[model samples]
Structures are given as structure tokens and as C-alpha cells.
Target: MRCVANTGRMSRGECSSIRAASDVGTAVELGAVVSQWVGRVVPHEGYMLAAVDPVTGVGCFLAREHGYSQAAARRLIVGDRSDGDHPYPFDRRARQSRVGVFNTDAPGLRRNEAMRDVMLDQGVGSELRIALAHAGTMWGGLVLLRPRGARPFSADESVQAQRLARDIVAAMRRYAAAAPPEPSGLALPPGVLVIGTGGGAIAAERVVAATPSAREWLDELGTRPADALTTSDPPVESIVWILTQTVRTTDKPAMTRVPTKRGWIVLNAQPLTGGTDVAVTVQPAVGTDLLPAMAFWHGLTPKERAVVEQVLEGLAAKQIARRLEMSPHTLNDHFKSIYRKLGVSAREELIARLLR
Candidate 1:
């Protein structure tokens, strides 16, 4: 895709911050950089950089604001069920066969089908979107939203945002290739792997233990665990092969973001310059841990996790009850819910399962 150069907004370091960031760091850096440009000196609602998987229409939220949860954001922005038709920005310029900025308030979007699906229906009164396109396909984009009745993105602001989007696209590709988010290699196994041509198992890395089938997911795209992923399964890889493929058609470093129940998972890949291997780093797009991920898969709510933390702390039932300000019966109910959700019958088993 074409990423035009611009000036006077993002600092050089901020533009290059993704180079040093982890997968999540890429998202954070994108958010911070764009905010610096848009916010000027003040913070706004927030922004998002999502990597789209064209085939499935599901990518992960690389970076977002505190007000927007990754899961919900994924559902709204890149989810197939949400806006499978009538994409923004790209569609606005589709007739001209170009990729550019799309503003919800512009005449270009007056009757746009995707606008309702993307912004109007989602409580976003106004938005500015820029698409990263290559080979007539959209790989990823930046979406800035405003609350209903808030001022819509001005024409000047939209132009600036679009220009910034283009400039960052090329820089992002370079940073991803030069220094991917992977650890030294899969020998260290950091929930990511690299595959060879023809989709064969070139390397298998250690994913989170409970997420046993992450290896197979790495084996081939669109494949899931052999067993049905119950509530306990980590959200399937929100793998993004779109932009990586777009930017590195023949040779380049590329990355993508996949959504999970707890957060986004970034899949960064680069062809090893000297070897046939393409290093792919699989990691969270945000700071997260096993407990929260596991809890999410098992359908454990925050309150349940709270109870679990107290239990893990060796708090007696009486103490736990007092702390939560609930009666003993209510505490027992939570215990029962936790046990059922976690598939355990006793406290010892619960602790063992959790620890394991």
C-alpha cells in the first residue's frame, strides 16, 4: 500500500517507537503516536490500530483506549459478524481505486452502508478512518472515534490523520522486520512460532501450558485445537497475516494482531535474511497474565477472580466473607460457582488446578 510522507506532528522517536516495543508495544506505540498527533497537548477519547485478517474478518486490537475493551473493539471493528460488508475509508475511495481517509460526517459517508455498522450503531457519532491497502486489499487501519453529539472530525483533521496513517505504514513495516517481537528464537518458546513454505511444522514453541493447542494453531491457520475449545480455551489466535503478506509479498518483516478473550495477540513474522525460516513472534498485544486469561476462558467473572485471589492468599472463609462484605452463605455460593466454572470439586483441587 502507499504510505505518503508527512511532517510537523509525530516526533521521529515516537514514529519509531514500535521498533523497541513488544507486540503489545506496537499497539501502544501506535496509540501514543497517533494521540500525540491528534491530541496535540491534551488526551482525547482514544484511538485504535487494528490488524485485519481479510479472510476471517477478525484481527486483534493492537492498541486502544481504556474506555474500549479489546474484545468489544474487535467485535465492532474487524469482526466478520459486525462489518463484513462496506468497509470504511477504502470504500470511500473505492471508486477511485485508492485508499484514504473517511470521515463519518463527510458527504462521502452520507449513505455509506458500513458507517451504520461501524460508527452510528456503535454509539460513535463521528469517526475518522484510514486504510492500509495493497493489491486492492485492505490489511489494517486506524480508527478514531468521537461520542454522539460531539464535534465530528473536521476536514482538516481528517486529512492530517490520513497523512499520518500513510507515513506510519511504511515505518511500521520496517520496524517489524528489523526487530520483531519474538524472543531470541522458539528454542525459548514464547507462545509464537515460525512456519516454512507449504505450511509445514518448521518449529514448535511453548505456548501458555493450558493453551496446549497453540502449537497446532501455529501449525496452520484456521485450525483449532483437536478438541472442542470449551470455556477454558484461550481465545483463538487473532492471527494477522494480512498486512505482513501485503508489505512483505516477496521480502519484508511483517506483523499482525489477533484478538483473545483477555486481550490482543500479536503475530509478528519476518523472513530470516540468511535462512529459509520466517521468524514469527506470538504474544499479547497488551499486558496480561495466565490467571486472567484462564479465568476468561473458564467464564470466571471479576468477582470470582477476587474470591480466588483471597483463597490463594490463604484467607479463611470467615476472613474472606468479612473482606467481601458478604454473608457466609453468599461466600459459599461464590465458592460453588467458582468450583463449577473451574471444574473443581474442592479447594485443594482448585488451588492445584490454578497453580498448575
Candidate 2:
């Protein structure tokens, strides 16, 4: 229905359809509702719906059908190739399209009538388009189309569609907010570290008093053996000695990486943070386990191992590809192999293994 001229009114039937279709919950349910709504509102040969992530700017196709539900029309917007020879109208640039209500007969529609032609190519005729927005953000949208001889969306129908869009936005936001946070991947035993300037030793002392392990460590710190070389010249060495000596009496592995002016040192164990800040932040090249090592090995092909060695040396994929005279796709294929072999899911895991 033509949303711009509808004056935002809805008949009982239209209202019922809108309400029934906009009650989105899970992604699957949302896909079903959107498909049904498109079938009801658009007269096109096919239809589809898409939801865009607000934070990540990634667009995901929600639903599509070819002959009966504006499916061709939807594919034109999303560049899904199976919809025969129909040309895609929308591209990545569509994200920047201005948001507002527009008449089906407006000049903007005429200028951008590739959307209309795609429907016509599929034997559908007219169309109604509406932009969905929430808190000024364009998060998702619906495009309704009708066959050439069919009636366009009435002004009343368009208004109802806009209201439905608002409801969908609210539902999506609530669903996203209530979702649980994903895990961070790192696992640690129950313990807390007190970190501060040297002046805050009292706070550290209090932490030690409250935690039995910390109390024992601090008590041991005060009774260093005469053979122990006490030196403040290398702050990192001092910290490493303290950590190692305290944890040596216990079964737990001691903290192994201590920051030093030159870089960092591997204490009783090997360095996990690597020797560089970038590696430390991005992959922490230390404390990794077997899965990561396997994933790394699996991600590579024999020939690509040379490229991967450069990657390990901190070279960008583009640079490595260029140096190896290989396409980025080839490099990517190697990485996928590496990921499969390593039994881990990502490059970060491989990097973590190297660091660890």
C-alpha cells in the first residue's frame, strides 16, 4: 500500500495482518512473519526480508521466495543470483539511502526504478516501499510489490505498514538486549590480583590478608633465604622471583611473564605475551593449548606454510600474498585449512598458541 498518502490509517483486516505479522521473536519466527507479511502486502511474483545489525553494520537476509511472494523483488535488493536474470537494484550503497516516506509515484522511485523493473522482469507490476527506522537508525526494511494490473498499496495500508515497522524495531531491540554475552575464551582459576602504584602497598597488603593464598605468598616474601639475590635494578626479575617463589610451594603454575624495560621475561615458565605489545593485545601469543596449535597446523596447506611463516612474522596477508605471488583467495583457503587442522575456530587461536 502507498504509505505516503495513507494518512496513517488502517482497516480492521489490515490491522490484524500487521499485528499478527510483526510479533517477531526468534530469528526463525521473525523470518516466517516477515515472509507472510510480504505475501499479504506486496503483489509481486516474489519477496524477501532483511535484518541489519545496528552495531556491526552487517546485513543478513531473513527470508525469500521466488514466484508467489515478491521473492524476485527481494533478491534484486540483496543480489541473490538464483532469481534468474533479474538485475540487482540495491548494493552496499543502499545503506546510505536517505530515510523518509515517499509516494509510489515519486520522482525518487522513478529515478531508482530498477527496483520496479526487477519486479516487472519477474512478471510483477507495481510496488510500495517503506523505510523502517528506530531512534533515527535504519535497522531493517520492507518492500511490498504488486503485479502490473494489481492495485498499489492504498494510503491507509501504507500507514499501517509504517506502524508495523515501528513495532518490529522495538521487538528487535528488546530481543537483542536480552541476549546473553558470548564467552571471552580465556579461563582462569579463582583468584584476584592487586595492581597499583608502589604507594598502594597497604591495599595490596589488605588483599593478602583477605585471601589465604595471598597471605601465604606475602608471608613468604618477607622471609627470603640468604641465597636469594635481592636486586631492585631489574624490576621484572624481582617480580618474577616473587611470583615463582610463592607459587612454587603450591601446585598452581606461577605467573610466567613479567614486564621488563627491555621487553618481557619468561620466568619459571615461558613467556605468553610474546615480546611485542601488538601481539600481546591481539593474540597474547602465550598461555594457549593444544587445540590452538592443531588449528594453526590445520589452517595451512604445505605450499601456504611459507606464507604463514611470514604471517607468524607479523606480515599482513596482502603483503604476504603479494610477496608469494599468490591470490588472497589462495591465502584464505590455506587459513581455512589451518583452522580445520588446528581444531580451533579462528586465527586468534593460532596466534595465542604461538605466544603461549
lDDT of 2 at 77: 35
How much is the lDDT of residue 180 in candidate 1?
21
Each candidate's number of clashing pairs is 3, 29
Query: Could you estimate the TM-score for every candidate?
Result: 0.42, 0.35
- Tell me how far the alpha carbon of residue 133 in candidate 2 is from the true structure, in angstroms, after superposition: 0.8
The residue pairs that clash in candidate 1, if any, are 24-285, 231-297, 238-258
lDDT of each prediction vs. the true structure? 0.48, 0.39
| Residue 202 CA displacement from its true place in model 1, Å | 30
> Which tens-of-lDDT digit does each residue in 260-293 have in candidate 1?
3232344656765774555566654432223443
| Local accuracy of candidate 2 as per-residue lDDT tens digits, 1-356 | 22122343446775555445544444445545554543443324434344443322223224334433333433343332233332222222233322222223432233145544555566555454555555545555555545555555566555556656665555444333222112112322222233222443211211111222322222222222233323221121123223322332243443332111111122232222432111001011132221222222123344645654665677788988888888999888877766554444766665654444
Worst 10 residues of 2 by lDDT: 276-285
